[model samples]
Target: MSQKRNIFEEVSDEARDEQAVQPGMIDRGRGGARKAIRAWLMVLFGLVVAMIVVGGLTRLTDSGLSITEWRPVTGALPPMSEAEWQSEFDKYKQIDQWRIQNQWMDLADFKEIYWWEWGHRQLGRLIGVVWALGFFGFMAARKIPTGWTGRLFLLGALGGAQGAIGWWMVASGVTQGEGMTSVASYRLATHLGLAFVILGFIAWYAYMLGRDERDLMQARRAKEAKLFSLSTGLMHFAFLQIIIGAFVAGIDAGRSYTDWPLIGGQLLPPDMSVLDPWWRNLFESPGLVQFIHRCAGYLLFAFGVVVWLRGRQSAHPQTRFAFNAVFAALSLQVVLGITTVVYAAPWHIAIAHQLLAVILWALILRARFLSAYPVATSVRG
Candidate 1:
């Protein structure tokens, strides 16, 4: 108090005090980076959903096997000239799918299916480019938040693997000669299953990044363990149902049975063991596969009800609402599934059913997330 402070020393002391008061200022940059990455991921999520819808159309149109070769780099370009188009068509003609099922298809007919498959592949390539550009751009600028680079990279890796799996699925139909017109049911299931897995990761990451890291950590302490576990089971059950549904789609099993609450007018449809091996019937027999899918749907709905009951008991309104949405979507999807069956799985109705699965999947994930990191709400509600 006796000594006079230097002007420079006083300024430095004030600056240090300011820094101490706003320690989080240093982390603001990271937070901003996380927000940007989340926005980018949201874009990827939309593209993926488009890809799924387009893929559904592709399968419905019987266009998945139009392209016989897997050229990740060179195949992006569609046929540029008549000669090129003929060359591609010739290649397609050599495949079993073309020789047996589509021999009557002319160049014009081939072009239609070609465009669907080509467009689907093109969209995939675009997704890869977007991911690469965003990830590398962030890496170059050193903007990616801590503990996130690996997760982003994992998405890219899975995407790359998905491309290979797509080829694998296509090859199943192409390789088999005479009487084989579609890909193996199990292979198709794998391809679709992976797609859902990728979509789930994107959604979960986006949701997590929407909130502050500290807030999420704090919310975790109040996690509803029972509800979380039930939701977890529901998620897995839903995924299994999706895979089973894929098997049904793979062989047009949904079209095989139009009657619900009964299969072919019986608890179990006849000819389930028409295939040589009993296990093969599970995947190859239309009646057996459809039966399993129906049973799984009922079980899934029952389990969803149980989970919703537990979720309703949560003190948090947002968490409760999340589960409510899940139940509502689940119920609607069940109705859609039934309608699709009653209508004999027409392309329009079937595609709508598939898209609803996407919605239900997202809602389930959101509900599970809320269970784990519930949003705090007032007690008055």
Candidate 2:
């Protein structure tokens, strides 16, 4: 039997090792530079949040129209000399905001407001530069993960479009004949809505990159589809509420009704139809706009509760904790919203409310990401 042994009966260890398959190109390079990419995204996220806060301050201080021009390239340097400052001020004087509302502002006053808007625009420029350098640097180094080139480029494109839209919003109020003192309410809402959208994409990408590619693949098999769907709906609802809040800010609606649970001591504000045309009241009427914002807040809170209940049933403790954080932020947001209104949207309270909205949005997104790629736990743990 030993003398007649077949060659297939046994194989050497080296032969077996030689026949083993290896990972393909896609698998081998699946998660390139994940940690570095996430770090870059987080930096962008912080800048966007700062941009939002500065923007809100500009609007509150009636300084958004101070620049009066959108010179994307040359605007980086502020007015350097008295003559340049005067020239810039002259351009601002042509706008209705100057003619109608800021007649009291001298050059010194103008400089103060100018600095606010200037800082906002400067921050925007900084974000663009950071994005460009990071993205191309990654590409040049061949460190970007597969399927991520287009995703990263999209951020820059959207940012460019946002700059154009910012000008569009400013143009609405810079007119000579329309008698406009501020940007159109709908345009403001549009501008703000896009910011939230951009912020959301950054946050989601960061969350995805937080885990290893193999881990994400395995986690996807255990995805809670229903919970993910619910969280998605909740995200949209929250975004809608943010847009409504922008409209409220656009027309100074928060100051119109300092009383909560009642508008001017009534369930509904009186004279909602005071604005021309029936539909105009929805966006143009302070009383009506604030009323709608209040109602939306209530509905958002209710929907959040339902989503939290669903999230609590998740099998993973990490997912459960994510949802709990979301619910906590949502509750704090509601309280801040009320405080903002009762105090008539003071700069401190209003800014705090807006900041909390950003936090809540990020938390909801984190919970949704967990639903899609939940972390696994052992029975003993």
Candidate 3:
């Protein structure tokens, strides 16, 4: 049975035809949107770099444990007066880090470290507010793409978790040791790892979202399989190195064994057994930590070099450059690490070493991301 088409149906069909004839940009409005997203990402990137630097200083000055309490909303504002400062100091004194490790440490010294941790927390709060405001502004403007807002939300969630984790890290020392001041190496590693992951995610997403319209959905999504896997593997290896490096920092291992190429002129430092089960010493013993950091450094350098050469052969200059940057930055990181150790981890060199580690982390993250979607290789030509 054939049905006659009504005027309404005919007009609907015509409307559909008109829509189908619209320009590509009208159909896919990603071009301009991408540029705006990119500008946002650059701003975020700067914030993250600042966070990393402040965090490094926090770690360097042993100020990370200064703020014993975690108050999400109220903590953003620093203590208001002398009374407020004393009140905060009183709370800190109850913590084991004060009663035991830093016993008799005057209020003046306490204020010094407290201020650093306070600034770090305040910056964190500012970042949260800025991101929230910006995200809402973008959403209202309809600038964010579908499938990505959730990821951005995830970043915000991670920031929240980070604050909790920072407290979790501080709590460990408070419970076990008296004013011990030093936190567990593992906790420090976790803190650092989370920070790196969050920063990397922000950077990677920005790079993807900011490309020009003519470039957004081009040929690059093709090789996501192999390059992505390779870059991810390399990043994993680098993270392991970073964790080992933390172990070194935790025990102040650099101040002891400055000799390189071989730890103390031997494959392993002598008397490397203390924690009963032998393996435990690797975590608790300064000598073993130094030994591990040195070995990890070699593997990190080698792994990055291989990735660079391999990326160069893939016909993607960004991929190659990422690897090259990773290799070079890592090499410089090694030199800095050695100098830091040889000089007994002086404040300047120590700070530089930490900064370079941040740079190395950034490079490795770039390699992982660019490899996932190599822009140069996806040319439509």
Candidate 4:
């Protein structure tokens, strides 16, 4: 027995020596690719932020539905000639917005709105191309895990679905009577809500796969996961708020509630009973939609405050981060919502307000991810 070495143990040792793989094998090549991915993801996130802001602009400027058709493959190629421009306009002419509402509008005016919708579509298209190319490049270069490669692919697929949803949303207005100029409230909300969902998911997934949380302490990880879950819960609330907000925007609801802490100087707003039996009015009445959005804002801010107060004791940088990020963003968003109500939403201010929500949300997600995993550290004797 003393002269014998176990064959299995011998083989294991030989394999270890030959392969030279370490305990940190997963982290190998993760460094460069992770950095690259972070940089690229930051850019993608910025573009999404830009697209959202531009979308707000398109809405405020009343430029949506300018193009009037879904030409996914050919749409990528813009109007190149006068004839093509007229052809596109002719198609738009068939729609209710053009034929009934904007029939008197001239070509130059059409161009003004057309450019906005075109910019929106083109930006979305660019996001798709960049994400796909960067993802594939990283995979081929042996930078990211095959698992992540699959996830990124699915995200790209989501981008594709979003395009279809955008058209579906636009097609709603087209289906309405000849004088209607805007998409259905529900469709509008769906397109906007879905965009935020996809953006949030991408940001969260990036934080999960690419971020290294080794800087955090062990106790913090357990605590942060709970907080992260809470933060995620708040995000769900925020989304509902967005849909309510979209209903307001769709019906020009916020435009009328030009006062804070009250609606038209009243507690419950006058005439909230628009849809007969009262229940349906929440979605149908602009007053009710704005009112509900305001209530949701209060709830969201309150949740953030509670998460921060309860979790401040966790001995983790990210625990503090999780609480603070959500609190700060929630506070700011609440304020912005009020101002948008009071000031009637100046374009630049409104756009900035929306963009900050996205920024704070992504950071809050970072906090969540770090709290869950913490950072790996070596034991020191």
Candidate 5:
């Protein structure tokens, strides 16, 4: 329909229609269901944290080798009958852990440890399902943001690898004639290290997705590069510490030295040259491993302080707050580490310490993210 136009008419229907049809961020292929994906990731994050804690409990209770088999699918279901329970217990009796340490465990006692390992595996399976559903759901709906499909897929791939690695770690202890009571410390380190890596990726992705792309792009211009670098270094250092901690847990090294500031009241534990191959001492010697963990903890705390000071100098209030949180967590983690050692790494205290590690890891990652993509704030008080 034609409309009467005034002499000063400045716009046309075609022009208005064009303007209305103009693409936005979503139409431009720059966006997705960001908040939805973030929520999904947060769910995965919590599950992964639970997995870590449960894994810790499994190790603490010496229950990691209970299942004795890696049935990714069939393993999801625990024994339903007494016969099935005895069958599972029979497999446990074949392992070195069962022979030397848990020889006294009857069918009833076997069930106790079996449940812990089963719960740990079950949590892992749950995390995988959550990731798969979220990833595939977003993929099928074509809602994943540009350049994010590969990233999301990587998480799932690593998760699969983690399952295989879990089996590998368990297999190390399910040996004959080696007298192995636990998994190889190195394998444990690798498994735990990968978990932290997955966690870091999830956290970083969520942080980026929390804000609008345009805002993130703009924030990139004002990034505190030096602070970001420092935080990056701190993050890597902390990850190394976590891997070493896994070593400590693998061998129950924390119980070797109950005193702080000294090992057996000396600068080093007695008989550092105990292991025959010399290299074996690094992994097999509890005294040496715990010593390394404690020293690394001190160094990590010192470095964390340095990074925090630099973060405090940032102009952005949000960035400063994030770093402050990191420092607080770092301080608390150190104290917890000391207490865990003092208490001989009791399951409760040790799990708390491990839980704090997860918290600290996330906080450090958050601080690093802010340093890289700072949130803008007003100058006015």
Candidate 6:
């Protein structure tokens, strides 16, 4: 004998089945942690740009060797007292840069350059601290996204190496005796090149994190192979130009030849092989260095135009616009480069040129990322 069921109560097998399975289903909540980490990275990105600009200023002012010592911790605290300032000045005096180049710099003058280098170093320390706190905080809470722990760690590692390289660059000028007023051109290029590398990583990471993981995975299906390859070549070419530009700055080559579209009133300057070894002239010869920089600039612009033309053919409007920006920046940068040469690379113009390079670098990365992950738009767009 079975009990009679109440007719007023609903008996739905589908509803029961749904309720039973709901608890076992995975919960993919909104990406709150991912967004938070991305925001932190953006902050780090800004700081890195600031670091680059400040470094350029420090070099332009010839203040990179003012400290003469690497005191990562103690050096953060600037000399506050008169005696401390004197001690700092004395240390700088022992360096060859002081004896040969800055012999005229008194204590008061020394203080000015000292502050520039000090500030540059202090900013670097600040960046490291920020990265450490953000990274560890995310890690401790287990908020770091899957497959991102190693990438985040790489940033800190590169930053640490940059600091050591900075010291090495400064040491080059200090240790070299007469006729050496600045750091080695090659070492300076290494230091600057690393800075740009770190910048590129932060930029690419930020861009990837801007979209949802699934969306990015889906977009990868529509990747533009040709555009990505072109942009990759453009990136490498731009980087080579940057290193060459560093060599120019290292030897004050910009001021040596103040003519554009011509070097020393000709396509090639007179003393290209003046240095003993032919290779040494490439790095040490102002005319040859500047000439290489100029030639690279022309080639970069031509290649950029080619990339932009291909990028214009992209079906996505946003991708097309991204490449358009790259072209615009490349054009402006070319103008600035020529102007920089015409005016002998004044501090202001030179710094602007360097900063523009940073902008162009980021733009190229953006275009490249878009090519790899084309953003879908409406047909009308």
Top model by lDDT, which number? 2
Per-prediction TM-score to the true structure, in the order listed: 0.93, 0.96, 0.85, 0.86, 0.94, 0.93
Candidate 6 achieves a global lDDT of 0.91
Q: Tens digits of per-residue lDDT for model 4 on 83-176? A: 9988878877777877667888877888898999999999988998898889888878878753467677777888888889888987778744
Q: Candidate 2 or 6, higher lDDT? A: 2
Residue 270 lDDT, candidate 5, scale 0-100: 88
Off-target runs (Cα >4 Å) in candidate 4 are 1-32, 176-178, 212-225, 276-278, 375-381
Alpha-carbon lDDT of model 5 = 0.92
Q: Write the per-residue lDDT of candidate 2 for residues 1-381, one digit (tens) a residue.
A: 346658678877997899988655344877789999999999999999999999999999989989887899999999999999999999989888888888888899999999999999999999999999999999999999998999999999998898899989988888886789999989999999999999999999999889877788889999999999999999999999999999999999999989878898898899699978899999989999999999999999999999999999999999999999999999999999999999989998999999999999999999999999999999999
Tens digits of per-residue lDDT for model 1, 86-134: 9999989988888778989999999999999999999999999999999
Model 2 lDDT, full chain set: 0.93
Clashing pairs in 1: none
lDDT agreement with native, every candidate: 0.91, 0.93, 0.76, 0.76, 0.92, 0.91
Report RMSD for candidate 5.
2.9
lDDT of 1 at 234: 96
Stronger candidate by lDDT (1 vs 2):
2
- For every model shown, the clashing-pair count is 0, 0, 4, 3, 0, 0
Q: Roughly what TM-score does model 6 have, to 2 decimal places?
A: 0.93
Taking the tens digit of each residue's C-alpha lDDT, what string does model 5 give over 1-381?
A: 987889798897887898885545543675889999999999999999999999999998988999988899988999999999999999888878888988888888988999999999999999999999999999999999988999999999999999999999999999877999889888999999999999999999999999878888889999999999999999999999999899899888999889978889999888576999998888779999998899999999999999999999999999999999999999999999999999998999999999999999999999999998998888774
Q: In angstroms, give how far residue 58 of model 5 lies from its true place.
A: 0.4
